[model samples]
Target: MDCVVTGGNVKVLAKAVHSLSRIGDELYVEPQEDGLALRSVNSSRSAYACFLFAPLFFSRYTIPSGHAFRCKMAIKSVQAVFRSLASLEKTVEKCHIELEEQKNRLTFTLHCKHGLLKTHNLSFQDSESLQAVFDKDSCANVFRLLVDAVVHFPPSQEEVTVSVSEERMWVRNHVEEEDQSKAMLTELCLASDEFDHFSVQTHNNVTFCLKELRGLLMFAESTGLPISMYFDEPGSPLVLSVTDSVLEGNFVLATLSDDTIFRSLVRTQTPPPPPDDFMNDDIDSYLIAMDTSIAPGPSASGPPTPPLADSLCQKQPAAANHRTRSYIDEKEDDLASSERPPNKKFCSLFFGSVLPPSSQMNTQLVTSQEVLASDSEDD
Candidate 1:
């Protein structure tokens, strides 16, 4: 099998290679008629990431008809060959990839500018492609938001907690932020209006890592496109996906349970917040008390979103609904000088929900009272 990648796609392939390196030392490459599939899974099994580059993404794609080609190589080997990814467009004329089945080496040749040339032989073994298979239809919540909204990640942060209610969706640092060294939790909110389609079965909240999420964000930072997020509930897999005209990518991350996070935090020196305040901002607390109704619960009655493409990529709108204005309403606060128990779990949340009109809530309550009074009199 032989394939050629030129132009900007070389850069795209480079980003894919870098992302797979995050998961494990081993990298799996599969070439189909449509495009190439790259996959990696961490040793801990906490995360799995995949990248798909459509045939159109390549300048020239070739393989035997009715057959797929795949191989496994150390991520270090792949990186060694594509060392000039950052300058591939300017430094490289074309990249020709071929499989030497007899030698068990994947030979990579870099055709460079000014008549320069380079070749690298990366050792590999015949293997099957790795695929992430999950039922998107089982996921209860799905929405789309800007990449900029999320990539504001702080250093030294581990897991990220996503808190969703009827009104809004937001994510904050999953690790306890009480330590002075670590900055206050970074929260990113997505308004109801900001989402092209936001739906949830219950007020679903889950905690996942930012590693894979950051990888995809970095890949398409130049595209400035809206990405899609879909998940079911706590202790389930979360899928973050992005789509372009000819390419798509999916990052499957396993979500940690609130209890699991709490237990882990218990083993740490950081103090845990009050239960009600756990994982949620003070505002999310106020909203939870009110009789907010008739929305966010529509997941039960709504139609199931089409499953992800070939069970990996989730197709989304090309453009999001534009808004003329924006708001930066809340700011995270520093922890108090006094620390609480080290064993209690810690969680934080952000909400950008649009509150219903006060009059509407009052009217609904009044109607319920009137119906109860009539029933009492009849009895």
Candidate 2:
């Protein structure tokens, strides 16, 4: 497999890689007769992303006659190669990708200006094509949102709830069951006019990860396109997509089944029941007097324990907590910190282990020789 990407399209490809890296650890590269498919699924498999770059998107495209070439490699292996998008766009003239069957390696050769070339060879393993099966046509709710819609969300926010109605749409940070009291609820409401196209057959709420949505939005924002959302019930998967004439991206994310988020929102909206008229007006004074009168002596079982608040306020010595590391060590620590714990459940079951032959997909013939790149790489 071999393909070449030239001009500003190189940045677009780099942006695609960076966006996919945000969703999963591994990148699946499939060089089909029609186009090149790049896909990724997160650690928990709760989120899956696919980007198909048509032959027209590349300067030249090529593939072997009847052989099927598909492989999976660590996303970081490829992401690092495009880490510097600015330099790639400014200095690189053409990006050539090829598969070396003899060495079983995928090479990314950057043909930079002044006859300079930077090549990256990544190892990969043969794998089946990763795909999820979902019918967007069945989705009762469909809406288009601008990429800037996420600006209202806090950077550290994880999940978000999307509530849609006939008249309006609401996007808010998800409130978990455990942290409702301490969690800050940030919500953004959009009228029908705000969306490019808003249609809601079902007035429902769906909750999904904000991180994955933001990742996809980054790509959409780069392409100067709006994101379209298709979803059904709460537990069902939510599909977000961005498409152009030559390239398309689809992200399938798992939605929370429970109504905890909705309940939290309701609780926040309604005021407490008038402080309960049953409580005597003197209750506050009584509690204050009891606090001063509590002078219990140590019992035979054990000495009196500290109050809960006092115990929680205690802190360890600063010297014991102080620490330092070298730059390399710090980088390793950062990478390790980013690792997520695996979830027992995933949306892959919805798509199954292998793609169904009847799954909805689009394919187009290559118009350029540099368009088709048969390659997969790993660290």
Candidate 3:
């Protein structure tokens, strides 16, 4: 009979069952809030069953007829519960899960050896689930282990496979070099449709394959600097062909589409004016002049000598007249000496009488003649 108990203590029922049963016999005890029932069976049992209530809050004692076994079992159960809860908390803390809503589904097409493979319709909901799967510890560990195992035992022939899911589309790029995988992944992320609107084309329910090809080509052009490109377009299957020569002297396979062509044309054309310092023709001319002037050259204007010559010519006559006036002042002093006072002249003559008469007569005559000549020259 099934009986429902609304409010109960499980330990009280266990006590009731112990009181009703014999020491060596097996008993089945059912507990309820209102009442307790016990039935005895013909068996010798060492184990005693005890039910615990409020497992999270209160600790209940389940004493097996023996003490040691009861203690061990209780500790084990509690430890297990604690460990499980701790693990769950850690998992929740480490993860960041989010959900988004999308108005329309998005899809991608991947080129494989067998031809084009279309991906499933992807919504924002799908992205969330994909992110969660990667976040789980067990899933992440398993994925890593699988990759390690694959490296340890590589396949004989190198083959590539493409996978397309609702969230993302990727390829198993089995190149001989491991370093190339990272480059390939980077290219894929760059070429993703989320970033560039021009690279995505949706008609009806399906996304066109040419759009993905265009994205690849655009990525190559942007990142692979100074690239040589070749385009091949065939009538069948509308396949676009692209070949890119990277800056690193390596080749990348890309595809051509309308978007790719447009991007190529845009890159080929000169960029628009900068926001603040637009190209100024005047500034350019000024810079060119400065550069040209740095080198030694003949002056555009004539030599500077005519003004100096004119200044010298204007000062010559005044300098000559100043010199002539100084000479006239010197000659006047000599004439003044000849006209000294008579007493002073007689004293000088007396002093001069010591000389010979001829010398004295000659001196007087010379003096008189010099005076007459000076007067006549002045006139």
Largest TM-score belongs to which candidate? 2
1-379 per-residue lDDT for model 1 (tens digits): 5788887777778877886776667787877777777877665444667777787777777765676667777899898888866677789878888877778888888898888888998888776445544545557888776436555667456667776766687776664424635556566776777787787676666767676677777776744556788886554567777788877777777664322111111111112233453232332332232212212222333422221100111111111311211111111121112211111111111000111222111100011100111111011
Ranking by lDDT: 2, 1, 3
The better-scoring model by TM-score among 1 and 2 is 2
lDDT of each prediction vs. the true structure?
Answer: 0.55, 0.64, 0.20
* lDDT (Cα, tens digit) per residue for candidate 3, span 1-379: 1121111222222222332132113232322232222322111111112222221111221222221110011222222222333233222212111111233322222222234332233331111000000011111101000111122223332222222222332323323222433433211211233311112121101012222223223333333322222112100011112222210111111111110011100011112223343222233343344334423311212221221111000011111222211011212123223211001000011111223334322211111101111011011
lDDT of 3: 0.20
Model 2: lDDT of residue 140: 90
Count clashing pairs, candidate 1.
5
Q: Count the backbone clashes (under 3 Å) in each candidate.
A: 5, 8, 0
TM per prediction: 0.64, 0.70, 0.12
**Which runs in model 3 stand beyond 4 Å of their true positions?**
1-106, 109-281, 290-379
CA displacement after TM-score superposition, residue 334 of candidate 3 (Å): 84
